[model samples]
Target: MTLLDVTGLTVTGRHLIVDGVDLAVSAGETVGLVGESGSGKSLTARAVAGLLPKGLTATGSVTLSGLELLGARERVLRSVRGARVALLMQDPFAMLNPLCTAGVHIAESLPRSPRPPSPFPPTDPGASPFGTVPADPGASPALPQGSGAAPTRWTRATRRAEVLRRLAEVGIDDPSVADRYPFQLSGGMRQRVALAAALARDPELLIADEPTTALDATTQHEILMLLRNVQRARGMGVLLITHDLRVAFELCDRVAVMYAGRLVESGPGFDMAKVPAHPYTAGLLAALPSATVTLSRLEGIPGGVPAAGDVTGTCAFAARCGQADSECTQERPPLREIAPDRHTACLYEVRPRPRAEPRAVTPREASADETLLRIEGLRKRYGGHVALGGVSLRVGRGESVGVVGESGSGKTTLARCVLGLVTPDEGRIELAGLDLTRRARGGGQAHRLVQCVFQDPTTSLNPSLTVGSTLAEAAAQGTPEGRLSVAELLDLVGLPASYAARRPRALSGGQRQRVAIARALAVRPALLICDEPVASLDVSVQAHVLELLRTIGRELGTSLLFITHDLAVVRQITDRTVVLFRGDVVEEGETARILDAPAHDYTRRLLASVPPTP
Candidate 1:
């Protein structure tokens, strides 16, 4: 019997969204809802949770445990929410209260959780060394020392013990993490705490909505493993909603492809990954940029999703699909089974492209003596708190150097020092023999020697200016007479000249990234510093941008100081890698060698924490 069932789900507000979609989740299975932004993946989940915003009318039979959710009253759904089903929302910081400790938030989630027979029972035969213990009975356990909390109430203390255990299970080894507020921890660690809190109630249905989107690559892998363990132990059905097809294939038992508020396909993980039947699904799989895939065949859908309010076509994806024909444009396809347990919503059967062959990036053409960036004993002190402890590194011309580290590991600080944005207390940085520490502040030669592409184009670009105008501003030099047109810059970045007239807000995340790259190349900086450039884009788009960066690096012979948390991306982009931890450089070597055989203890932990690649 279906644990949760929905048929002909139609959700509409002031716009056209979530049209006639059907889905079901068994008692103990994971179903992935994969799509890009505004595809109605999230709106469908919200309808199930009875958490839709006001004025939204949902017309469907959302029967969970024989109770309809579409029109359910708030009071009724409240009991079902934490007690029966829990939601792990997209933004961890928004999900957590800033003023509360990790312990405080986790405690609030367990409204009436099942007791573990004993508050401090003996470890389960299957329990790992760092599993959640039963809550203490009779008396609450004491909080960890130096948590900045006075001897507290028994209930609060008991909750703290359970919270600490949960955090540890989610790969946060620092016991004192329970004491830190949400603001103190890194994005990945905070999300781990949020997951711990969500599972505190142990609901039968877990709705994980892009829970790992904001984390570093290593943390993302760890969280995936933790969830796998949790799913096996709890036997809970999960509805994992995300834009990452890779994550869906790796974690979900079954996958559902959504496009413009409709189910385009559904099938087993391996089947969908290996051979997708729908045109949209096939396009999505083909766009992934893996080490194995060549650039000739990897291109994304040309247009964005149909407007939420104007989705009145035969097929929502017809506008962007390469194979779309008259029939595809005239009538929407129904979700019909093409094979056992594999459904397709396409007029014509579409074949999925072959998986890319993963090849190690072998860009070893740069000679060692042709140094592009050189750092010596870089140190930064923030009122006695040292951030970088005698750090030093070098990058040869035409090289991509990867920087890997936990949050606050001096990664961004080092990037800032290299960019000359921050004055280091000690040591010196030079780009092509030009002292960045003593650059021309009056808009001189030093400014043209290096450029930086920061994270989040939304904030980095001037919102008021068009993409064309912003690119022009970056190219501004001493004499106003020597200026390059914005169209030339856009063309250089593989964008249409028409895009030069468009505002930064009008571009997609991937497009915005390309624009940023163009702006950085304006003065032709010898070395480029990229801080998580692709962190904001979808997986398929991420592949394209990485390839773009690699192409630019090769074609221009521009050395890069690329700071990212994604080891997968590192493997395909970086020639050499350096691992940092707690303000100290842990290990530095070739990307393949370091990942395969890390020498330092911290580096080993990082390597171990990465989830086993599927």
Candidate 2:
């Protein structure tokens, strides 16, 4: 049965942001809505759940289990939310209350009086209705003649037990976690708590919006497996919204591609991966960096997605599409069935391109005498927790070295120590034979020797400043010969010189990251440290950023310390790889050697955790 049926869904605010989109999810099915940022995937999911932001009006048919929900009353929608449907956002922190403990959050989601059906059914007939063994296995037997008092419909003891049960179901085995606040938990732990809360109400339809975007590969795989298991056990329908095609293919039964507010393609995950029918879908797949295959360059989509109201009578993607012509620009193609159980909105049929042979990357060996940055016996401690323990690495001039590790594995901590943001408990950092450790302690001139590019450009770049102003500020601090005009800086990063006048808010995610790179380049630092620089970007944009970093190293002769959890990205950009596990360097060798034949068990586990290339 169709659990969620959306037909002709149109969402309008100042303009038609989400145009006519039709999607469906069946019971026990997982449907993936895949798209880049600002592609209307989230808005469509919100509209289906009647949770659109103010000023955005949704007009269409939204049926949840045969009940219309688009124009439903607020009371009706309120009743439907949590009880019949649940939404899991990208950031669990945003959904969880800081003041509430984990137990409180889950308990609040539970219905009072008559309880809903348990999310999991009992395997044994004699088990409790809540899908657990009896709370007291050794309790005395009931009285033979009329018990003194029958149990109430719902009790405090039962509610507490249910909350703990839910937490355990989501893989939180420790009961003490229920009393901890959101801030006390790790990123993975907090996400599990949020999942427990979402299932507390026994929702039939769950909409997970990028739930594992910020997690490490292992944690992401764990969450995906947990979600799949819960969905299968309860027969719940899932609408997973994500930009990662690999992730979508890993767990989704059906995959739907959305582009510029429209459903461009829909098909089975296997078929879509093997042969994409739409040009845009193929473009996204081609842009992805591979964990197993090596490419000289990623074919990133040339241009950004068109803003709403930019495309009127033509296809929204035609401007960036390589296959587009005058006909594509003149006519908008409606989504139609192109093959059995497959649909596409392209005018011409697109078949799978021939697989390119993996290119052999020649590793750049840095001689010992030419090293630009070197660390010896690096260590950091926060109370009893050790962040980095005797970790040592070196980066040669113009060489790109990658640090791959999960969260809390000393990647960011190491970067911070190099950036002088943290004073290491013990270590020696040398830049160009200068004692960076002493410089950091003495407030010396290390800023001119090194610079950084953070993960989220939105937070790194000041929102109030225009692109030109931010670049100018960084330029002023650099050597006189290194300073360049704002326009020159913009051009160097492949952005139009005209973009100098725009602010960070005015640019797309890719554009803002370009501006960030331009600012970093303005300093003309000898060493560049990037911490998860492209983690949040879509595939094409991420490819563009990675390529830009490579170009900067090649053309400008700047050494790079690239820190990220994505092994595919490391394979594409780094010459050498260092694998960190729990504050220790478990492996370090040539990028190709480590990726092809990992020596350490932790390194092998990290490689195994990555979703297979679709």
Q: Which is the leading candidate under TM-score?
A: 2
In the range 342-372, model 1's lDDT, one tens digit per residue, is 9987877785555455554454545557887
Once model 2 is optimally superposed onto the true structure by TM-score, how far is the C-alpha of residue 546 displaced, in angstroms? Answer: 0.6
The Cα local distance difference test for each model comes to: 0.77, 0.86
Candidate 1 deviant stretches above 4 angstroms? 112-176, 291-301, 308-311, 354-369, 381-386, 438-444, 477-482, 586-614
| lDDT score, candidate 1, position 295 | 36
Clashing pairs for model 2 are none
Compute each candidate's TM-score over C-alphas: 0.86, 0.94
**Tens-place lDDT digits, model 2, residues 301-407:** 88888755677578888888777889998877889998887999889878554444578888778899999999999999999999999999999988999999998
- In terms of lDDT, the poorest run of 10 residues in model 1 is 133-142
